[model samples]
Target chain A: MSITREEVLKMAELARLEFSEEELDGFTAQFQGILDYIEQLRQVDVEGVEPTSHVSLSADFDPRMFREDEARESLPVEEALGGAPDPAAGHFRVPKVL
Target chain B: MSLRRIEEADPALGAFLTCDPGRVLERAERVDRDVKERPLPLAGVPVAVKDNICTRGLRTTCGSRMLEQYVPPYSATAIERLEAAGAVVVGKVNCDEFAMGSSTENSALQVTRNPYDLDRVPGGSSGGSAVAVAAGMAALALGSETGGSVRQPASFCNVVGLKPTYGRISRYGLVAFASSLDCIAPLGNSPRDIALLLGRIAGRDPLDSTSAPAPVPDYVAELDRPPGRLRLGVPKEYFGQGLDPEVKAAVEAGIRNAGKLGCDVVEVSLPHTRFAIADYYIIAPAEASSNLARYDGVKYGFRAEAPEDLMDMYRRTRTLGFGPEVRRRIMIGTYALSSGYYDAYYGRAMKVRTLIRRDYERAFEKVDALLGPVSPTAAFRIGEKASDPLSMYLSDIYTVTANLAGIPAVSVPCGFTAGGLPIGMQILGNLFQELPLLRLAQAYIREFPVAPPPLRV
Candidate 1:
């Protein structure tokens, strides 16, 4: 399966990442190689095989495994916001979204 | 003693991304003081932490420029447990950026070389954790594994590493690479130390609902139990093409040693083994893409300096924050999970994962545990596979299957190459069978103790 520069760009956009021209070329080639390598998975006869999203789910579902949703002690808002790169009045300050 | 070693050798070895001697000493003193009131199991033991696991107030960089200064607000459950059990935190060690690569060379922060051979790569993303334990900088270290992060490095560094059964340890604050496959593992000089660390950390935690509700066994005590007439399976697929001759020989010797310990060793086939890499690459990256989407410039971590709007900021910030390998994985994951391609890649890989898991299940039905090589080869020279991403991914060929299967596996030092690089034999157990695996490893180590590498540090 041949990958196109446009597809790479679309992936970049979807991933919320940007690549320089040089880095993009390198990444595209490496990506193609990886894609080719992973293409081997297509050969497996997966008909009727149950897809495992996570190993924990492989077991019968148990509602008791989940913690009580009741509110408990949590990090203070100050601590929660402490790592934010841009913080303002009780919120993370980001650039204009609209 | 660990502090002194760190002071003496860490400068040259680059094993730590953050080692504050004063802070470590203070914690050690506190441990000493607290022991007077009540005895702690790990009293005064110095421990190194991988940068990916959160240590509140300490920068958990995940070896990425994105989180270079991002100190977590809370500690991971493993870290909290270790500290509660009287272990002192030595420092945060380096890892592949966001624990994404097979070698520490992907670390954007610093380079951690193999203590065995400085010119060679420390099998990573847990390279620094392995280095810290191997070089005597710490008695124990916490390393996280998505693929071969812990076991591969343990093999390279000649330290004992354990990737416990999935959910054996809580992932409350471990910086997620792939949520489905991620595990917080332990590294130490001996199987006993690993057992001690594992015992302290493995248990049900309310913070992480995925942590198994099963009771945590006394792993240290389990090590003393004799492994009598255990059925040890040697996976035929693990010994196939691409396995280095030296590594193969060493693992063969390890299998023989197990037989000498009264084990009924038999060759077993994990038929879906070859598909593990492709399945893992797809599944892990797909999960990583979603997990990492939270790293937008808004809340935490690095943000682009200037942007016209939010989208531009998100794009530029991630571009600048994440290193190449991280970017590559994110892109792959994005593509795999994207619409139209989902079933072909992510969906199919998940089914292949079931086949892989079933292979282990079937093997375990006949054998108590499986023995194999932890890595295809020992430490390679730095930059040897840096430019070739595919080659680097292949280094994890033997290791990723355990993660995919969600089984407990350990890396035990077996023998060394003629050139003196370390080789490790991997012992994998059925779900929550860490006890038998540790016992078998301890028994093997007792029988054939491999000499440590000549300490260049």
Candidate 2:
């Protein structure tokens, strides 16, 4: 019915995240609150009503999609790094590892 | 200079986390030179882009340290179009990290304050964009909506936010939140401005495969069309429980204002509104967790220093990089997708999602358009729900269904709470019905434009 700390741990494992002690305590309470709110749905009789997915129910026309199958524009190496915080001759530079 | 004004003002205003003052001013000058003889429509307009959009020369942080220094190599298609239309990029505005929350309060970078009241929060994801435009820092802004990111913030900030029907605007360069549910939209101080900007941006794009081939309607001209037979639907679900009395009253007043302009208002029930939030959590996260898997510090983003192995690098980088909300959704998504839980979670949610769409279908048959509150409450104080995640997620209750349905929706300033904080009434049109929605919003603005949003320090 509601999210449990165990559920949070299970979720964290599935998500591959490691939480701090503070975070674990904080999120458990938070996620539980959301689950409780969603439980409000259980009160409504949505059994017979068709569930709504999109604002528009029409499923008529689908757009025609196609691509040239070619790389149209490839920026030169210099232009590619123009936005990088730190850039070398042709590539982005990161902090030294070894 | 105007550039300094935004940075200087936005810091306290919380509109911009990073202001590219030098670049924005320089780019404005380039617009002058590059477009001298032939003036572009948006020539010289300084615009703020939500951090989630990738701008080629600026760091595309998406309000997270995960992309703290990641400057995208190429411009997002929307940004490219805006620049081509002669708008200079002022800088990136802060947002809910990865646009996962309703209140911009979720952004780890900096929370954008509502221009109306400094202590109150701006609505999320596109909060900074709305604040930037509302505060006069920029004439226009770019925001994306998976749910209410664009519209809700625009309501809080009293700007106009337009989320075109899915694929009305190219999604080629937006950082993905929920792919099927997301869109790059426009925000402006007024409905007319939204129409003008939409004219320049909406259309088929070769790069975005999802873009519809339908001719991009001339939004500006369409704004003037008279409302002769406009049948607007008022969904009872949106105006119900948890909605502040002041906000509900304001929305009804807004409907009356629209009625005065010859728009016919009718009550329509989106019967499955009850199941939307539950359905959204399942579907959106399932999509997002999969989309975000690329950020494992392997291909092109921040990587953490780990003890030896590749798993260590992936684990440490993701653990350190993403914020709590981002991690939460990713986990919810992953669990829903895991082998054992896939059918119960992801599969069932997909069925519900389909049913939710059907609810809208049935409603639209009785009404031409739908109206509702963009958000349940007016702007809340900073940290109001920061500690309570469920309450925060509920903040998007009114706005999420449209995303699930993939329809065009817009949030325009309708009225204000007693405290003068703006409340927006949302307009949802059938898929690809952006032109009519803009027209209706414009009509409402013409009849009763809320007073300019207060600019508090």
Candidate 3:
């Protein structure tokens, strides 16, 4: 039920986040407490129980009726990039990857 | 008038995060122009929107530093509908960062205080919205509930709050939190007001594929029907451990009052109630981990200043941008959905979720609606449960079931504690049965008229 510091670090890396040493310690401790609380679910016998991925508990849910596929106008480039911290040539500017 | 009221009360309550007077005036002028030609339902009524719900030209912060200056290009379908119904968008209000926490204290932007008493916390991530309505800053407010965000705050603030059946309201343009569980809801002074707001916003949208195509009911019209000979279930689990005695007494009195009004109040059981908090934690975080991956440095939102590489940029931006609670949830979700632990955590939680939903289905068979306390306790003081995450999560014990089952639920002011803090009575209805829920709530509100909090500007 305990999450180790190494495991926390691994999860943090997967989540694209980094923490300071002090924060890592605090998070590891808190994660352990939360996991311990959540471990109570293990006691329940979920034999043959179908997993509910969504709350469409009603019987009328149909997956086939998607919106019609059609071309439509999109946000103009200026509005789309309005909140961007760095915008150049009508695109979001990020650090060089190559 | 609402702008003046908000300007006066906001200094004391910290309810609003942003208020653009220019936009407010312009919207009011438009409503004025259209009033003569086309009479609207909510003509010139000001509304406070939770910052997570997108507004076309206004900054949608989600109470996070990540999107502090991010103005959405498009508004949420609910907001569009509200505006079309003549509700004026007053301002964006504060909330927990990414709607992660139970309290507004987690908001990276501002600390929203309870209007009832400034010392206590306004139950949140919709704290600001609830405070706005309770303090008379706005006529109505919009709140998004992932767990008990809307109802619990409504309970604490002594106002009416409603979370409709999942997919009942379109989620298009709502900033995603936990996609499966998040719901756009409302807070108001009365069930009729909540019904009016619900009627306007509840409907299918082509933009959101998950929005149910069912025809929206006339919630306002339906409120006129008298609820006669109703069967209300009192869950055995809700009255048990961890419930504040005053809150339990108040809710029980409300149930007895229902019995006096000819409701057939009966005892029922939801055996899987204990597993709800655990199930919610696992599922919400798992989905949030995936949904929040979009806030990388490349897209709009806060980006770390200088980065060595793309990977580093992503890591540093998120690390610095998100508050502690958001990072913790993302980490928990990432760990749960990780390759090795997926089955033990996320998969198992989903199965438990099915059992929780089945519990409601079984209970609803014997009753027209379920009655309980919206929150285990009334509003606790600020910073009381902030340090302990598990205790804070436990505050949502009674309210998460409706979201899990996708049933309509409303929180109505029942009574108050000795200290004068308000307690709420929650009435839950079957899937898409919002009409009966509102009728029952209207009956209760009619009998016991809840007074507004004593925080007049």
Please name the candidate that would achieve the greatest lDDT relative to the true structure.
1
lDDT of 2 by residue, B215-252 (tens): 88888877898756788889888877898899999998
Q: Model 3 chain B: which ten-residue window has the lowest total lDDT?
A: B448-457
- After the best TM-score superposition of candidate 2, give how far the Cα of residue B287 lies from its true spot, in angstroms: 1.4
Model 3, residue B329: distance off in Å is: 0.3
Candidates ranked, most accurate by lDDT first: 1, 3, 2
- Cα deviation of B56 in candidate 2 (Å)? 0.7
- The TM-score between candidate 3 and the true structure equals 0.98
Q: Candidate 3 DockQ category?
A: high
State iRMS for model 2.
5.0
Rank ordering of all candidates by DockQ, starting from the highest: 1, 3, 2
**Model 3 error, position B122 (Å):** 0.6
DockQ of each: 0.81, 0.31, 0.81
Candidate 1 chain B: worst 10 consecutive residues by lDDT?
B448-457
Q: Ranking under TM-score, best-scoring first?
A: 1, 3, 2
Which is superior by lDDT, 1 or 3? 1
